[model samples]
Target: MIRSINVSSATLRHGIIHSPFRLVTKPSNGLRFCRVRPLSRPSRPSIILARLYSDEKSPKENIKPTELAKKVLQEAAKRENIYTIPNMLTFGRLLASPVIGYLVVTHQTSWALAVFGLSCVTDLLDGYIARKYNMQTVVGSVIDPMADKTLMMTLATCLAVSGDIPLYIATLILGRDFLLFLSALYYRYISLPPPKTFTRYWDFSLPSAEVRPTTISKYNTFLQMIYLGSSLVFPVLSQSITIETAQSIGMALKGLEYVVATTTILSGLSYVFSKDAVKILSKPNGKP
Candidate 1:
């Protein structure tokens, strides 16, 4: 019956300490009694219980290395690189491109105008923020152009579908872009290590393969945007405007379309003919 009693600290101090809730035969008393005594060092069950309670409150101690790495990466992603202000604007523009295309195809001119206008503003803002904050990243360099091209092509397709612009113009622009994309991919992955055809024709040094937008390409993009925005805006007014006025705007749009098409072709040709492009594709000893 005394075995049910709790162990006292005084009994433990007197060297009677043993595992709690265990029966023991005291040599001095020659009688069975439960020795309820706290161990000087923690018992196995106490150690396990302590770990269980501690793990409940501070679970990081139990996290595996892989999970820790994943968590750290997730936390770090929020603070750097893609999450920056300029990059966020770029991503937002990418998301808005589909909406712009949808609005255009659905003939929601007013809503498309608003969204397209906001995208244009963000386009400017993103560049400015990147420059002012020095927040540029290699990924941004790649995706910024990608976002621009996607938006441009999307709007162009919508315009062509709506009969606002010639389908051939969109075809030409997209064809050039597709060719440039292929060339860039080839230069990046296959040009290095100097292929036999490349080494036989030209002599040049190869650096990192980053396909930057040429000056002509920049102008081409600007003109394309101007053309697209005008195309979107003028049609909204076609409902309230006179035929002569609408025709005048239509003529301007046609002129812009021609200009854009010409620039698109020239920019693509410029890349193909540029010394840098040649150097990137050629070897150091070959001459052309």
Candidate 2:
């Protein structure tokens, strides 16, 4: 009876342990089982990466127009053709003209005289530099002569107004200028052709055949400078030399004035008679 009881108990325990519900509910034989869906990683932000690359490359790709212009200007400045010593001297003389005029107008006679002397010195230096360095230019040729005439004319007018120089001297100088202007106009218009060849005596050995300063013209320039310098001294020395000395100096300047006037007239006539001058004058307005 006891053995039967024991066997029954054992069978009951085995049935409980091997039940299918228990097996399905719990893991068996130390193995884990899980049903899981595959994970989907977050999508990479490609748009943000593209924008970062574009931002990094933009400055290298974009160049401003002004920067390009500055580069071109720098290249132009590096060229060898433009800067010359003679031209620099001529520019200095030109700049001096206005300063001299201002000094004279302001009644700073000594300063004006000093400035005028500087202008004259620059004139000589320009010519010397041009010859020494072989740095002549067409622009210099025109500008140099024009600057000289302009300075002389300004000084003469100012001195006349200040009563430092006789009115006759100013008149003579202006008259000469006027006559040359008229001749130039006539040569351009009515003459149809101007004379080209200059007399040996009238030629100053300038490279240009059309315009050359004569020996007389050079002397005239020297005398004009002397006259102007003497006027500056006359005012200070008047007490010592008395009226006679002033009058004597005035007479001498007047004589020089006549010589210049005569030479100018004769030279103009000679230019008018030159064959090449005629040829140049004869060209029609557009026939160059």
Candidate 3:
């Protein structure tokens, strides 16, 4: 027969059977459990924090702080009226000039063609957009033409070094640019204050030269770009196509080159002997 007894504290006081607790306790299978205190509720601040953070978006992984900084800077630049779209395009071309030259020297004809093509497109686009929108800055007047000159000089030098084009042609092309650069410096030196060390090193400023491209010079530049582009592209195409086809294209480019050379020489001479050029170079004393 099974027996069950309800023992009070008085019965447990004798220590005949050990009780685990001095207060209320229970026993089962020779183990004792005392009454447990309940856990306290979370603090108000903790609850508020949990609720506040619960719906927040998880932080994006693999995002660089520098990248975020660059984006913020770009937005700030837009607001500050410095990096307008047309100026950005001109700056891009300036940056690309060296890469194009490198590609030409390394015999990466296809890539050179692609880069030169893009440069041409951006050149036209930047000028058109600037004029159409009336967003021409004083800085753009200096930088846009400088970018064009730099790209032309780079391409001419590379082609001359590679022996794909005659050395005299490159010399003629670059000599014109050098003369114009000197002319600009001469004008600015007379007109403006002496430059700081940094500005002097670059030889660039807002008021450098306001010389617009002569119509003949514009055609000359177009022809020069065409000649350079064709020189890079034809060699690559010849590798895939027949020699006869390549020869025909080569003859056409040669013909174009002659026209370009003639125009280039004429434009340079015209620029040097122009009334404005004479005035800038031979300024009268005490005229101010």
RMSD of each: 15.4, 30.1, 21.6
23-95 per-residue lDDT for model 1 (tens digits): 3434346655445444355454443333333433353345454554444453333233456888788889999
Q: lDDT per residue, candidate 2, 16-114, as tens digits?
A: 211111112234577654332322332222222223333333534643445544444533332233257776777777778778767777788778878
- List, residue by residue over 1-288, the lDDT tens digit for candidate 3: 223344322222222222222334677688776552323454443333333232232334333445544444433332224377999999999999999999999988878888999999999999899999988865676678779889999999999999888888889889998888787666655644333244543443324335666778888888888888777777677889888888888889889888878998998887766764323311223122
Scored by CA lDDT, what does every candidate get? 0.69, 0.55, 0.69
Q: What is residue 29's positional error in candidate 2, in angstroms?
A: 60
Deviation in Å, model 1, residue 276 alpha carbon: 4.2
Candidate 3: stretches off by over 4 Å: 1-82, 193-208, 276-288
Q: Runs in model 1 with CA error above 4 Å?
A: 1-80, 188-208, 276-288
Q: Which stretches of model 2 miss by more than 4 angstroms?
A: 1-83, 178-210, 239-251, 274-288
